[model samples]
Target: MAAGIEHGRRSRPNIRIIAWAGAAALLLVPLVAMQVTQEVAWDVTDFAFFGGLLLSVGGAYELLVRASGNATYRAAAAIALAGVFLLVWVNAAVGIIGSEADNANLLFAGVIATGVAGACLARLQPRGMARALVATALAQALVGMVALMGRLGVMSSAWPGDIFAATGFFAGLWLLSAWLFGRAARA
Candidate 1:
């Protein structure tokens, strides 16, 4: 009985496996879509890059969630991870501020960088994650404001609507994450 129980525990799939599988499924969606529609076009490099990115980010988040004892910390980490993944994926798929190659879109990376630096500084503590989340939220807002300025004719972008939409979506996610983290910290 003891041996069977231990074997069962060892055989169960871990969080890493689940994360990788989920990431693979997400990447496969576009690959399958490309077969039926011309709207989804991805080269080998794009597939590999995005696949690797999703897997890496998902695995990292899974590890963080599993290793943390605090529920609040786990929630904060998950929010931050999701925000980073979405921002990067959106920017890589199409330019947030303009075309995919638009220089203004690069500014959004600062938000992710801020989160990473905060994680390092806070050592992944709940309080630190809260502060980091707020900082990232601020960074996202700044990026959105820049995109809004472009929409107002302050920058060069024919697709100001796209810029506004992307910025608004991502900034909202950042703000939500910040709010969650703040609540966690307070609790």
Candidate 2:
């Protein structure tokens, strides 16, 4: 019994690492695509968005895991990530951040939020981390789907090309997350 417990303890970190690595790989897809396309197909900001999305997803996973472990931490990390997503959506909607403009400020905010979320998760529920990771990834995927639909000229009036582009990128991230989470849950 003690050996079984000890073995379980040793495997937790590996699980987290694997999940993180999967998330990281999903995040890198756009970057790799852009590089391979010679930057002619996609802009640098496109890659940046994927990077930010990865950070946000990874952070959420960490936060959920942390919260699961330490019931005292007050689920603020997850809430904060939600807020960041809202901010991005609002800013993008109001035209405060142009579709084509490379806005580092927004990206920076996202990064910070992700970092906080990750730290919180690391401290909290490391075991149930997959659920949180999946949730974040799903959110991103939804955003991507909306964007893809727009790009396909589905919602021309409501979402502009830029919005569609952003959404499409996130959608890819989320899909990857879903796969990872599903796999981890099964294992």
Candidate 3:
């Protein structure tokens, strides 16, 4: 039993290292693919920016996981990390509300801002996280509503379905995170 326990302890760090390695590979694959295909079209600056972003996001997630003892808090952090990554990637790749150039895309910043505030409010505690997650979900839902309005002809050129799709997806994630936090708080 002691030997088994010792083996399990050693494997935790190994799992973390493996996770980071996978993150690096996920970023590297696009770099190599871009080199081989003209369709991908990422330059050096794009590579550097995305590579750094991936590393920082993945490293932050790992740090939070190691720092938090509560499974609920860890899961919440993971969800927030994922939300940030997706937001950044989508914003960088092709604007969230429209394309990279649309002014409406600026509203997406609120989602990230709310998340930052939520983290501070929650302080990685289950009850606080529950409150924070609800706030985040509400913010996300508001963003979706605004996008829906923009899609309904408030904006002439914006695509309704795409905007609604992205907003709803992120909102759903926030809601799920909120539910998890609520469950954790109850437990």
Candidate 4:
């Protein structure tokens, strides 16, 4: 009750519940669809992979809330985490540059690796986190540059601006997270 304490502790169980329920519910959606349509066919590995991914995201969120009380810090962390989650999901399911099997799409891993490495180097501090996110954004943009320049992947349809748009969107998210982390550091 002294000063500037967040209700993060109180929200811990709530987040855990949400994560758990979310993972189950999301996994169920595909399972249900599979029964109704052949188009939705998914193996056990797919279910396991996604189930693990959802839970991991939730766990990361829980840890972040436990580690920092600043709401801005929490928000920044959430953005970064969600960005990674969405990147992985979309890349695995549909591919970033072409399709899921596109060799160019594999480059997205660099963005993730940069984020993880930067986070480790920064030790998750607000200022360092900002830098990490910036690096992440750069990595994302670099992949786009590389893929587009090299014409690296096969596309089912003719390539439009999809590659440009996808990379830009993800890079923007990384920058947004970086900006929030910067604000948190200043605070």
Against the true structure, whose lDDT is highest?
A: 4
Per-candidate clash tally: 0, 9, 0, 0
State the lDDT of candidate 1 residue by residue for 1-187, as single tens digits: 5643574575466656776777778889988999999998889999998988887687778667765666766776777788788888878876677666777778887988998898789876667777777788788878778768656333544566666666667667766766776776777
Where in model 1 is the C-alpha error above 4 Å? 1-16, 150-159
Q: Of the candidates shown, which would achieve the greatest TM-score relative to the real structure?
A: 4
Better of 1 and 2 by lDDT: 1
lDDT, candidate 2, equals: 0.48
**Tens-digit per-residue lDDT, 1-187, candidate 2:** 5643674564245666886788678766656776777744646775577567667656765756654443222233334344455446445434322432434225434433443464456443332333444455455444445445535333335545555555455444433443443443444
In angstroms, how far off is 37's CA in candidate 4? 2.4
lDDT of 2 at 120: 54
TM-score of each: 0.79, 0.34, 0.83, 0.87
Model 4, 18-109: lDDT tens digits are 66787789889999999999999899999999988988888888877777789999999999999999999998998877778877777888
1 against 3, candidate with superior TM-score: 3
Candidate 2 residue pairs in clash (backbone atoms < 3 Å): 62-121, 63-121, 65-124, 65-125, 66-124, 66-125, 69-125, 144-167, 144-171
Against the true structure, candidate 3 reaches a TM-score of 0.83
Worst 10 residues of 4 by lDDT: 2-11
**Candidate scoring better on TM-score of 2 and 3:** 3
Per-residue lDDT of model 3, residues 140-182, tens digit only: 7788787776563344365676767777788778777777777
Note the Cα lDDT for every prediction shown: 0.75, 0.48, 0.75, 0.86
Regions of candidate 3 where Cα sits further than 4 Å from its true position: 1-13, 151-158
